[model samples]
Target: MRAVTVLGLEGSANKVGAGLVRDGQVLSNPRFLPGQTARHHRGCVLAVLREALQEAGLEPADVDCVAYTKGPGMGAPLVTVAVVARTLAQLWNKPLLGVNHCVGHIEMGRLITGAQNPTVLYVSGGNTQVIAYSEHRYRIFGETIDIAVGNCLDRFARVLKISNDPSPGYNIEQMAKKGQKLVELPYTVKGMDVSFSGILSHIEEVAHKMLASGECTPEDLCFSLQETLFAMLVEITERAMAHCGSQEALIVGGVGCNMRLQEMMRIMCAERGAKLFATDERFCIDNGAMIAQAGWEMFRTGQVTQLEDSWITQRYRTDEVEVTWRD
Candidate 1:
């Protein structure tokens, strides 16, 4: 079989990313943020696509297929990337593939880590899920009932007026390193599911009191927040591993890039004799490479989406996608 190149666009969140993949290899991945507002998704998508193509030293016609994140993201951003992808496919006369955003993260994690089959923990600003492959689907073993772990951290950063330049969560992680005290915060984990709304509320209240009294610093709050939320995530991921009877765990998404969280997960996995797999910030965060890799699998399996069927949705569940590439 001849080598096929795919251009993948991702705009599921604030970050707009473009990636080129050929024969299971990523040629280039670039991202852009037009502005802090969500209104710039379209412009950012176009810019990143250009940047990615330039970096890969390829033209639009060179791509054999066009793939994009289809759903389970912000409606506006998803539609923006979807429209661009569909238009590009029509113009280039390339096959179009619609990829599940969550599944993209999992597939990308597996691809980068070379994990055949592992329990997945996908944590991001918009999603938190413990998943495992079962019967041609990425079944959700557990998830957040309220906001995601990343969302909780982002909100906490906002409360402290942290800069959102690179990422609010990144700044919080840095501050957390200097924290010597661990403030008590609400930890809510109901069975396999976790809840962050209560924790967020309690933390915000604590932040206000701390600011007024000048007792606790932002570093302390950041530390406590990371410790509490990451611990909950690790606990749930461990439980999922035990239930699935899988010895390997793969962490994906934005929050998965946190060193503290990864360390905690590593400790938990070590205690249970399970291995943990995680990628760097490039693949773990919202990136187009993951989407391209997943789309390649679908494209190879004859999973193509017509323009009519290529629509954006915010509530597309991960389990709704059929894993045709997996046995």
Candidate 2:
């Protein structure tokens, strides 16, 4: 059987990455420079697609499938890339696959790390879900009943006008590195799920009050925010491990790039004698490689989405995926 090759596009947010995958191996995975204000994501997506095509030594016509991020992203950016993807699908008359943004992260972790079965901790601006396979579907053991983890971080950064110049997360992480104290913010972890909206407001309020009274600096606030959020994520991941009876864990999504969160997760996993898997910058953030890899697997499983099938959701639950795996 001839191997199927796919050209993947990702424009879920500021970073637009493209890749070429054949039989689940990425021949090329490249991310365009992320946009700061969200206006630049469209052009970045186009440029990255061309970049990936050249890197793969293939043209648009070389692809057997065109896969793109379906939802759980900025509307303008997703629409921009979706239009390009759909047009390519129509022009090439090849199968067009739309992959879920969150699932792509988990699938990419599995691809890069070679983990058989592990709990997934997916944290990003648009999502914060802990997933495990059970019965006939992916069970969402823990999640944000409201705002997401990364979104909380971003919102706090925006409140202070912290430079989005180099990427908001990086800026926050930098500030957090300079931080010296743990301010002890609220950590609301009830059962397996968690909440961040209150934490976000609490941090902002504390920062503003302190700044006004000359009691604290932005770096202090930043450090406190990171501590609060990372603790919340670590709490959920540990609880999920106990809930799912799985020690092996995979941390996926953009927020997984944070050194602070990764460190906490690694230490937590070590305590339990469990292995923790994390992709570097490549698979950690939104990338086309994950989409291509996921598309190939779903393709084999006959999980293709129609052009008129439409987008599922931006806030769709991770547990909704019907499992075809055996325990």
Candidate 3:
């Protein structure tokens, strides 16, 4: 049998990405995200697609299927990429697969880290969930009740006027290292679920006052925020692992790039004699290669999205997709 090659498109939020994957190997992944708008994605998607194909040194005919992120993201950007994917699928006369964005992150993390059935922590700007696979689906063990942890960090960064060059969360992580004091912040973890909106509100309210009064520096606030939020995430994740009796823990999504978060999680895992699995920014952040990888699994398992059923879903949940590719 020939290797199943897939072309993947991702524009769920700000980033517009294109990538190619053949079987389990990633060929090329190019991304561009200057702004969060359909117009920006529309303008740069084709260029990114061309760049991915060129970098991969493959023609359109080399691909066997077209895959794109179908939901759980910004509406306009998702629709824009879905249109591109649909058009490409029709143009190339190939099958189309619509992948769940969260599943893409989980699948890619598993593929990269070789983590077998690890409990997953999926954290990003728009989502935060503690998940595990069971009964032919990825089940959500815990999740954010309001805004996500990444969003909390980004909003705090904005309050500090931090540069979003790489990402707000990244800048916060860097600043947090120089922090001398850890200011008190609300730690809200209820059962398996966590809440960040109240913490965000509390921090935002005091940040300016603390800075003005020399009570705490921006670095201190960032440190406190990171510690508070990551502790909540780690708490819930550990609970999920204990509940599932899982011995492996995996972290995925954009916020998973934070070394501090990983460090905290590692400590928690080590205490329980469980291994930790994670990826660098290349695979952690939203990228097309992840979508392609998830799509490859689906396509190989005889899953395809008909043209009429290719509509984008902004609120697609993590546990919705059936894990046909996995036993």
Candidate 4:
């Protein structure tokens, strides 16, 4: 069979990205969303598309299929990307493929790390999930019951008045490195599910009380928060690995780029005689290459979405989509 080319668009969160993949290789570097506002997402999408194509040395006519993240994201941004994708597909008379945001993360992680059949830990601003492949689907073994891990951290950063420039989580991670104290915070994990809302609330209260009493510093809070929460994440990921009888764990999504979390996960995996696979920030964070990679796989298997079926959704579940491309 000839190599198929897929142009992937991703605007699930604050990041709007575009990438092109041919066969199993990425043709161009991804373009990430620029601003926090949704007003520029449409323009970002178009700019990213044009840039990706230019970098790939290909035009719209060269793309065999068009794919965009369909759901489980902010509505306005998803709609913006979806509209562009639909328009492009119609204009080029090419096939349209609607990619799930989570699946894109997982598949992209697998591709970059080459971890076959590993349990996946997907953590981001909007999602925190522990997944394993079962039968014909990526089953959710564990997830956040309340706010996502990234959201918890982002909100806590706001409490500390940290800069959201670049990223709040990254700034918190840097601050935690200088921390000397470990403020005791709530660690709530029920079965395989974890809840961060209570922890976040408790930390906010602690931050306020510490500011009044000068007992605990922001560094301390950041340290304790990361240690406690990352422990929960590692614990749940370990459980998922054991339950699925897998020896490898793949970490994907924006938060997966944390060196602290990666080190913690590495220690746990080492103790269990397992391997941990993760990508750098370029691939771990939301990107179009992952979307394009997954889209190429689905497109090869005759999976395509019609114009009417390419609706954007805010609550699409990872387990809802069948893993038709994977055995």
Candidate 5:
């Protein structure tokens, strides 16, 4: 059998990631996305693809297939990349695979971790989920019923007027690194699912009061935020692991790139003698390569989406797809 090379494009939101993947190897990836602002993600996808192909020394024609994010993301951004991907697939006369963004994260973690059947904890601007692969499907054992963790952080950053260069989440992660005292913050965890709305509001109020008294530093606030939020996530993920009867953990999604969260998860997993697998920013955060990687696995299992199949779902349950992180 011939090895497959897929040119992938991702523009689900601010961070646009494009790459070339051949037989699961990320040959090259070039990213473009506004840190603090939204931009022409559609066009950016094209630029990323062009640059990635150049870096790989391969043309679009060299790829056997084209993979792009299908949906479960912002409407405008999702359409922006979808049209470009569909057009390229038509023009190049290649098979097109529209992959679920969340699933891509899980698959990438599997790629990097070699976790065949580990429980997954995915956190992103648009999602938070605890999942497992069983019965030929990625089952959602738990997830956020409210706002996503990264979105909560970004919105808080906006309130602080934090520069959105690189990424708002990255800024917050940096801020947390300098944090000292844990300001009193509410921790909300409902069963295996977690919520951040209350904590965001409470922290904003604390900032206002502390500034009024001129006694609080942003670092302390950042520390408190990361501490509280991460603890909540850890608690919930641990519960899900216990419920699912799995000790191995895999953290996915863009927010999974946060060092603090990774540390907390690592410590928790270590205590239980459960292993944890985490992909770095390349796979942890949103990227085109992960989508292409997941698409390749799906293709191998005869899970290809037909040409007429199209969906722009904002609330796609990750478990809806009947596939695991591995073939």
Candidate 6:
């Protein structure tokens, strides 16, 4: 029997990526994100697609199905990718599958780390959730009640006038390393969910005054913010793990690439005698391979999206999909 091959397109946010996955392996994953505009994605998607095919040394005919991110993201980018996937499916006479963005991260984390039903800490620009699989659904145990952790970090970066050449969170991470003092920040964790809006507002209001008064340096603020935020995340994640009786913890999504956050999670996992699973930026950040891998699973389970029902959904929930592939 031939291995199932999938070509995936991802444009759910600022990044636009194309990847080829077959038999649980990523053959090609090329990504580019100049901006978050639908026009930018339209300009880059074709080139990205061509590059992915070239890198994989395959043609569109070799793919068994086409997959694309279906939502919980920006409306325009989701629509753009959906339209492209639908067009490709029609032109190549292949099946089409719409994947949930959060589920893609979880599935990809499991695939790459070989983690079997680990508790997932999914932190990205738009989402923060502690999840675990139960009854065929990736059930959310805890999440951000207000602004997401990554969004908080990004906003803080903007306040500090940090460079976003690579990413705002990454730059903050680098700066935090140079920090020696820990400025006190609000730590909010109510039950299972965390809130960052209050912290962001507090920091933004005091950051300039503190800097001018020499009360604390930017590095100090960065370090303080990271420690407080990551501590809150770790507390909630640990609680979720304990509740689920899970022995493995997997971190996914864009902000999961932060070494500090990973370190904090690793420490928490160690204390509980649980293993920690994390991938580098390629898998942690948004990419096409994650979507393709997810679509591959859905397709194998006899799931496909019909043309009339292939429209984009900006608020698709992770638990909405039936995980027919998992027991």
Cα lDDT listed for each candidate:
0.90, 0.81, 0.94, 0.91, 0.81, 0.94
CA displacement after TM-score superposition, residue 21 of candidate 6 (Å): 0.5
lDDT, candidate 3, 94-177, per-residue tens? 999999999999999998999999999999999999999999999999999999889989998898999997789999999999
Model 4 residue runs over 4 Å out of place are none
Candidate 3 structure lDDT = 0.94
TM-score of each: 0.97, 0.91, 0.99, 0.98, 0.93, 0.99
lDDT (Cα, tens digit) per residue for candidate 1, span 1-327 = 888888898988888899998878899998876575367876577778888999999998889889999989888888888999999999889989889999999988988899889999999999999999999999999999999988999988899999997899999999999998889988898999999999999888779888689788889889999999998888888898889899999999998999999999899989999899998999988999889999988888889988899998799899999899889
lDDT of 4 by residue, 51-73 (tens): 99999999888999999999899
- Candidate 2, position 31, lDDT: 87
Q: Which is the winner by lDDT between candidate 5 and candidate 6?
A: 6
Q: Model 6's lDDT to the true fold?
A: 0.94
Would you list the clashing residue pairs of candidate 4? 16-33
Report the error of model 2 at residue 174, Å: 1.9
> Ranking under TM-score, best-scoring first?
6, 3, 4, 1, 5, 2
Report the error of model 6 at residue 248, Å: 0.1
The superposed Cα distance between candidate 1 and the true structure at residue 9, in angstroms, equals: 0.8
Pick out the ten consecutive residues of candidate 1 with the lowest summed lDDT: 34-43
lDDT of 3 at 97: 95
Between the candidate structures 2 and 6, which one is better when assessed by lDDT?
Answer: 6
Q: Which stretches of candidate 5 lie over 4 Å from their true place?
A: 35-39, 324-327
| Model 1 root mean square deviation, Cα atoms | 1.3
